[model samples]
Target: MIYNIYFDEANKIDQPGKANSYYGAYGGSEQTMTDITQTIQRMYEELGTKSELHFREYNHDQHLKKYFKVLHYIINQDVNINILIVNNTEAHSIAEQLNLTMMELRNLFYIKIPERLFYGVTRHLHGQLDVNIQIDRNDEYDALGLHSKIKEQMNAHSVYRSKRYKIASVVSEESHESIPLQIIDTFMGIVVFLMEQSYMADSNTTLIKSDLVYRFLSEGGNVERFIKQIKLYSWNGNENLSELSVGNYISQFMVYKARYDVSEIAKLQAIMLKNPGLLAKEYRNLMEYPNTLTRMLLGYKDEVEGRGRNYLLFQ
Candidate 1:
């Protein structure tokens, strides 16, 4: 069967920081992709929109229902997404200590990240898995000449190595032309944002973006399923790449509770929608806000429904 792979990257591609760079390839079988693309195309056509669908272009006022349906459709489909996180902050120091140039280290990642992503998806299946790849082009990979290396590396792995995934072709395409690319592009943006911005010490996210994020989390059970499809591959400089250390392991993406804290997110939005006036004009100790608000919301819930839903806290 033919597998369609749409590749996209998010975060600071070559920058140094926590959750800095992410390389992702997301898609499913050709038939699956075609049906999804046509469905999304009809959504846009129904709204008289002649533009690309992207998380970056997400607007709470304009595109809420559109994006909601998009996410809903994606969750109900069979898809796989793998993201490799390069903690350049750790990698830079690791490279420096090992006396290796960043270029050399980056070259290995270019070859291995996508290789690992392919391994992740194809490991379970068997027989002739012909893969077609379309990448959302970026300058960082462009400098590395990844255009050719991507196909070369994947085919080389499948041809000689026991890797079962084979690449038929790799091409660069605009998200506007392909709905699957746009879908990958959207979720790729979300994964990177949740990892990078929430981890930033002093970052204050825009309310509109957070609104979209809350809506993204509004998927409920689908959120967990969506999270499962995205796995993060990491090689923080803690491991010696030259030594090829056995201690190294690539894991899936994880986020702290502040943003992905779905319970608090739901409560906050519910409160904001129900009665914005009950909120304080200013708080002296902002650190005390969550607990204080939780108490208030619980009290309000009890008053309205005649019982406290303390059980939801465990979930």
Candidate 2:
């Protein structure tokens, strides 16, 4: 679906008695979702430059809001669109805000909002003109003016339980890339932070090789940065590829190659298989981290190959 909304309910800040106490019942989509895959590739290239390194500490809230706005802008501008809402228990109010008939909205998208608002907001937002107003839940604001049916649904819940709504779903759907982009963004942030603070190195040696390889595979296995970063790091006569931790460098490269379809990624994978010594002991030791995206990359490559896409990876 063009619109894949994640709506959270009872996320109110001060409402400990209510649902979603800390996060505040927020529902929204990111603009980048439509182009997330491409954006990840672009981010891969942009991370190569020192000037773009600040993305390490980039503000997540601001980026998410910006994407949300972008998505809304697109929906308002495009006609005959499809949308899905991941239903949240408390946000029947949003249904009233979007102006889509409940059935029409559900048919085009997946709804996950709490079921209480399902029918109420469905009726409220339908045929409404003001689609951009911000909504809030508090003593003075009862913005939704929800229908009795919704109220009855909420009352049906246990005293300690909150209400829920299930937005409808359509048989046909358009997949977007927001989730993938967010994943890539998170990794890029870590890479940038490591590089910016020089934590990328163990002692004297820098992470230039790993970072460069990260950028290379991030761009779908392009080897241009691989050559450039190696050359740059080796500028001093004493430094060379052999001096860097083989395991770390290879792991970094595998991460990028796993995400994209590149020509020689399999060749590079083969290199890792034939010469495990290319990565140093200490580098391999870091695999102790809780989640290994590098492993995921390997898995992704396997899946791609299974789909009959020309692929290669060292065992």
Candidate 3:
């Protein structure tokens, strides 16, 4: 079988002190690509939107339904997603400890992060599949240069050392021209957002963000069941990368309910009465407020409807 991997990055690429950086690669067979594109086209038609589906551009409550549908389509399809998360502050500390230059650190990140993510995906192939990787075009690295670096790393890895597994090509392409790249871009957005929320010390923000992600996935199918099909790999300036299960993350978040201030609870009640969708909008608004109560209320509603936990404590 021929497998194509589409790659993209989220957040500042070379900046050292930033909180988070993510590189994601998602792809499947050619047939799966066709199926995904067709489904996305149908969604656009239904929504009367002719514009391309870019996660950053369309992240809002009004577009939440379509976003959920797109996610559902990707999850139900044969595509695989792998994300490499970098804690830049930690990475910088490690670089300084190792006496590495900023350029050396950046190059290491660009090369190793994607290489590890790709290795994780390719290692499972067992030399049975031919792979072609296409990365989204970026000014930071030339196409030929990146292709060479990736090819060299793949060759060094034990997983691709077999004669039977052939890397057909590794090239960069304009994201606007490829549906799979766009799809991966959208997925990366969610991945980055969820990772950021995972680090938040505020229990309410963490719980709300987790529930929002759960609801988004639940729209397509059973979130628990669907999570088994996806893989998440996290790196935080450690010698080894760790794997996280979406199901377990959701379960952990669901069990914890932080006490909300009485005034905040009242605000949430008023917001729910006026427009429940507004809560979703607020969740998407990364700029202004934490809006932890909105997520708590949503989780409570889900519990009441028997879609999630059986009981949630407001206090």
Candidate 4:
């Protein structure tokens, strides 16, 4: 039987401060890599239907072709196996290069592995939004089936939870007043915009824009009015103010005035999520918090630090 597996490349070796070989470069503790891998594996087994099927994992340390070799050994004859590769990055050029490199591997494997036994999966992973779907290459059945399956799986999986407002921490003795309605409205608009841009990009695409939008709202100010002011001076005069389009403009602004402290907190959370080793330490910090902001920020920080840090580092 040709086993179809989804392939995603992650930098498992820790080097938090070193530059990424691909995507935006940065360096951090190897802890981040370990955490993400565990999360994915646990999530897959806990969430995926065919949990027992080996995922055929690989990382930057190994060349793409080396992975194909393992597949060749598994499939010698008329068995059919399909695998999809995933990564985090938005630049199409990067994805294309990875694909080309994979093709080179296939060529090498053709002599070693049966061509009939190995065919690329019809779909791949998106970098930014982390959405998975089959590529729409005019193949109706595969496209439809894959899209439906991915959607179904995501809806069913509770690997992570989402919340509306991000809170840092609250005192048990007192309640922090909710953010102004105007600010929340503006912040939500930015999220809608950022998420839109992210959806249009690759699955590995970092949610940098979303983070920026969140930060913009997080700062104390007349949120909507400030956004409107930013829009007025922006090139298109509010025409590009949707979540995705606005991200483009605001991203530049963030470069000039982004807060590292908040971003650092976000990064810390990302690290905790990926590295279960750090979870205990981080969870303890979180448990001490009396409010949702602390919990949410901690969670958000882990993801940002692990996956989104590079993007937010300078900005």
How should the candidates be ordered by lDDT, best one leading? 3, 1, 2, 4
Which one wins by TM-score: 1 or 4? Answer: 1
User: What number of clashing residue pairs does each candidate have, in the order they appear?
Assistant: 1, 31, 0, 43
Identify the runs in model 1 with alpha carbons over 4 angstroms from their true place.
16-19, 98-108, 139-143, 160-165, 197-205, 238-315
How displaced is residue 238 in candidate 2, in Å?
A: 67
- Best candidate according to TM-score: 3
Q: Which residue runs of candidate 2 sit more than 4 Å off their true CA positions?
A: 1-259, 263-268, 276-292, 300-315
For model 1 the local lDDT of residue 218 reads 42
Index of the highest-lDDT prediction = 3
Alpha-carbon RMSD to native, per candidate? 7.9, 20.7, 6.9, 23.8
The Cα local distance difference test for each model comes to 0.62, 0.30, 0.65, 0.29
Clashing pairs in 3: none
Candidate ordering by TM-score (highest first):
3, 1, 2, 4
Indicate whether candidate 2 or candidate 3 has the larger lDDT.
3
TM-score of model 2 (CA atoms): 0.20
lDDT of 3: 0.65
Q: Candidate 1 lDDT, tens digit per residue, 109-208?
A: 6766776666565566567888888877666567777767878867876777676767887777867777887888787777766655543343223333
Model 3 lDDT tens row, 1-315: 787888888876355445877888886886778778887888879887766557666423334446556776677776678877777777778888999986777777777777888887777665566778898987666723778888777766644365455667888899878878988887776565554545245554444444445556544354644566567877777889888776665444433322232344455456556665554546324223444344445445454346653133111
Per-residue lDDT of candidate 2, residues 1-315 (tens digit):
112222222223232333211111112222434454344445445434221222233332213223322222322321111111122223334445777554444332222223322222222222212111122222222323322323344334322343232322211111122333233233333333332333335521223223223432433333332222221111111222112222354455455434543533454455456556444332223332122233323433444346322132211
TM-score, every prediction: 0.69, 0.20, 0.72, 0.18
Q: List the residue pairs that clash in candidate 1.
A: 232-252
